[model samples]
Target chain A: MGDYALEVTNLTKKFSDFTLDDISFKLPKGYIMGFVGRNGAGKTTTINLITSLYHKDAGEVRIDGNRAEDDKVLYKESIGYIGDESYFHEAFKIKDIVSIQKDFYPTFREAQYMQYIEQWELPTDKKIGEFSKGMKVKLMFAGVLARDTRILLLDEATSGLDPITRDEVLVMLQKYIEDGERSVLFSTHILEDLEKIADYVFFIEKGGEVFCDYKDQIMEAYRMVKGGTDELTSELEKEIIGLQKSSVGFQGIVSREVGDTIGDKFLVEQPAINDIIVAFQKNMGGNHTWVQ
Target chain B: MKIVISNHSELPIYAQVKEQIKEQIMTGVILEGTKLPSIRQLAKDLKISVITITRAYSELESEGYIATMQGKGSVVLGRDNDLLREQYLRRIEEALETAIETARFLKLSNEELIDMLGNLIDDE
Candidate 1:
């Protein structure tokens, strides 16, 4: 009913040790949003809540502007989930998965399913257990795409994949949203994948939202600052995030606006996604009030 | 049309796409009525997000360099006189940025650089 294909507002889930606190983000139709954080950063917890696998303590999730509570069938029809683990039985053959899919999804297209199977070179005779990690990922994608689901939720789907397999997965994600009718929420700790294809990034830290913005804006928002250790005075240290000291110099992530105002007093360079994430972890104690 | 993207560049990926396409269109390297690669096709080829190409194409459409017909892909527009002038001016700005960078590296004062430019032109 809205432009967004997926919307989660104030989504919270609690467990004994951890609470996924106030996780909120929207994936607009026709785009991919990388749901990123380190391991134990609640990335999977948030995905579970989004898929309604876990009961939420608060907030709601809407798929295509319809809540699961409001329209269960429609919500279910709209999503395809690809977890890091194989959903099928280890003994199940490709045809077994296909038959199961046909029973579950009314929109399943057998021809499309077979086409992807052949295209990805997935063997029909082999059991799921015989498949390599890349082959398993392809098989999962083969199932998900055949259902013609409009939104895809991939949780750590690329972690164990080799580089070539990851590239294949990235291409699949790009292809999925080509029509501008679909969206994807890909949760992974792998920043390399996110950097290549994420339209928006929702970075979670310690069960809380750290920052969410367009991928371009995220890259442009901060700078890596470097200077001699003395230049990193106590007063100056307050301005930087995750400040690090060596015998020769110190380097840290600094707010770009602040970096600019400080002029050339420090060497400011562009930061990679890894730099930003690491800096966040290092400076967690120092208050990231500056990170938007 | 050919596009080369450099990760080291400060220009965002989308902006790089837009500028390159704009340059090609203005210079007639990409001709009028040329069908630009569909957004998805470009993204796959460039190994970038579809959003980046979408942003680039939309910006191109808004700037009147190209037109997107529903269901069909974008196609370049006929040249405009004012737009052509603006494009040429952009080339000069880019050239000057390089010149300025070199001058600064050499520690040439702004005035000295301007005087050098004047002397070179007068000698020509």
Candidate 2:
């Protein structure tokens, strides 16, 4: 148990080829956290462990202060989750799926469901198999929204949805945040999406946590310093956690503490989340950072 | 409101957002009192952090381009186009001054600079 809507401590899960090593993080209640990583960066594995699909080899997972294993069904009841892949019955109509969810979530809102169905224009009568990937995503989201769960865990929820559908989902998620008690832990490779709504961010690579901080903290603490390659001596380069050189020059992440060290010769500017991700990977090695 | 975002632009995310809204207000894409998207919506649309969008909106409001109301979201304030144009031109002139200084430093002659400008305009 931890002081968060969701908390995982030293969670490790191993498969034949991949191992999620000692993963840990926290999503404080009411904050939307973007769980960021490249594909195969253990984003899905972490989500699975949280949802109790895969038992952790060693770790503690608590949702709303209850150990996830104490009462798996009750713990799941307080959380609404959408996996990286849709898991509804192929033969079920969107309406049928909604009904099934209604049976499960005590706090399910029929009116909200109706409104979302109308807002998203989801074809309720159409079988789940007949829905386009985007439509299926909408259905999944609408259903989740109706649950009114205390915490929402989404794994790549926007991966395949069209831009419009993606925005619609974001709007609905924002609406869900109206209570100020609900929280979300969303994992995705799309840094752009995280940039949109995430108040907190956690970056996972090679099965361990790499970066975890408030969105504003990251923005304020790190900067992108651009300078001519010749200007970047090893001493100056060491001031930056990540550095990359191009034909034009060099760009890298420098802590604000090192600003005076680098001086005014370089263009010091804030780096985008995507740029930060790339810089973090470069810091690890020129190759992909997380997966071996 | 014709908003131009250079995908390769060096401007910060907040600055880009501020400029886009400024353009919208100046060009009438967003009329005075027109309700703009919520901070969350703007962030999603721009694919930027809420903090970034919040800074942009706050800066815009302070500059009189927009006003934010609780629950109502940000709204355009009907800025004077003349004011906006003057600001835009001043920025361009400053950039041009820097460029001219650089050109002079590089010893580019008037004729060579004119030829370069002509080629650049033609490409545009």
Candidate 3:
């Protein structure tokens, strides 16, 4: 039990091909936490572990101040999870899906569900099997929006959506956070969405936690430094966490304070989320070293 | 209005966004007095940071292409004759700066560069 809606301590999960090591992070109550990474970066693994779809090898997971493992039903009740793929019956109508989920979640709001269904313009009687990909995503989002779960875990929910649809989805999710009792753990390869909505961000690489912090802290604290390779000293290099070099020039992530200390010899640019992750991955030998 | 962005461009994203709006203004696509989208709407539309769009609008207003008021959103301020004249002078100054830099690189005298410019302008 903690102040966080979702908390993990030194979480580790292993598989034949990959392992999520020492993954520790938290989502503050009622805030949106964007779980960000590149492809196959163990984002889904973390979501799976949180939902108890996969058991962890080590560490702890708690949802809404309750141990996720100790109270399966209560944990499930508190969490509404949407993974990379869904298993809705194709032949089922949108109404049918709502009817089914209503039985599972006591707080499921039929009035709210109908309101979102109409607001999102979802096909009520139409079979979900016939819906477009964007429509399916909208349907999934609509379902989740109507539920009263305190914790939401969404994996790559807007990855392939068109700009307009993506915007709509983003607006929907942002509006979902109006109820301060709710929180979101949204994992996505689409970094732009996170840039807009996430209050905090967790960056994972190669099944390991790279960095996690408030979105503003990340934007303010790290900088991308560009300079001639010849001007780069070993001492300067030591201060950088992720150094990327090429024949033309070099770019790396350095602390904002450290970058200022380097003086006018280098160009210090704001580091984007993607740049930070790539630099960290490159520094880790194109693989990642767990920081447990 | 249509706007194009080059992936190869090194300009910061906010600058690109401002340039696009300015282009629309310069080209008469976004009419004077027309209400522009909200910062949130534009950010949502363009898939960029809200702060970026806010900065763009702020610059546009400072340059006199648009003005923003709370709740009413941003609106295109009709091109003032004086402002247009200032814009032209600004463009010429920018061209002069570039020409001066190139002349310095080539070690060309100011007179020589003026002669070259005369010929180029005559050719145009």
* Top-lDDT candidate index: 1
**Pairs clashing in candidate 1?**
none
Query: Each model's C-alpha lDDT?
Result: 0.86, 0.76, 0.77
Query: Which candidate gets the maximum DockQ versus the true structure?
Result: 1
* Runs of candidate 2 exceeding 4 Å displacement: A1-3, A285-292, B1-124
> Residue-wise lDDT of candidate 2 within A57-138, one digit each (tens)?
9999888888866887788888788765667888898667667777887788888888978987877777788878887777
Total colliding residue pairs, candidate 3:
0
Q: Tens digits of per-residue lDDT for model 1 on B94-121? A: 9989999999999999999999889989
Model 3 chain A: worst 10 consecutive residues (lDDT sum): A283-292
Judged by lDDT against the true structure, how good is candidate 1? 0.86
User: Model 1 residue B112 lDDT?
Assistant: 97
Each candidate's DockQ score against the native complex?
A: 0.56, 0.17, 0.07
- The reply for model 1, stretches above 4 Å from the true place, is A261-265, A290-292, B58-64, B67-73, B87-124
Q: What would the TM-scores of all predictions be?
A: 0.86, 0.69, 0.65
Question: Which of 1 and 2 is the better model by lDDT?
Answer: 1
Instruction: Quote the TM-score that chain A achieves in each candidate.
Output: 0.94, 0.90, 0.86
Deviation in Å, model 2, residue B75 alpha carbon: 20
| Cα error of candidate 1 at position A164, Å | 0.4
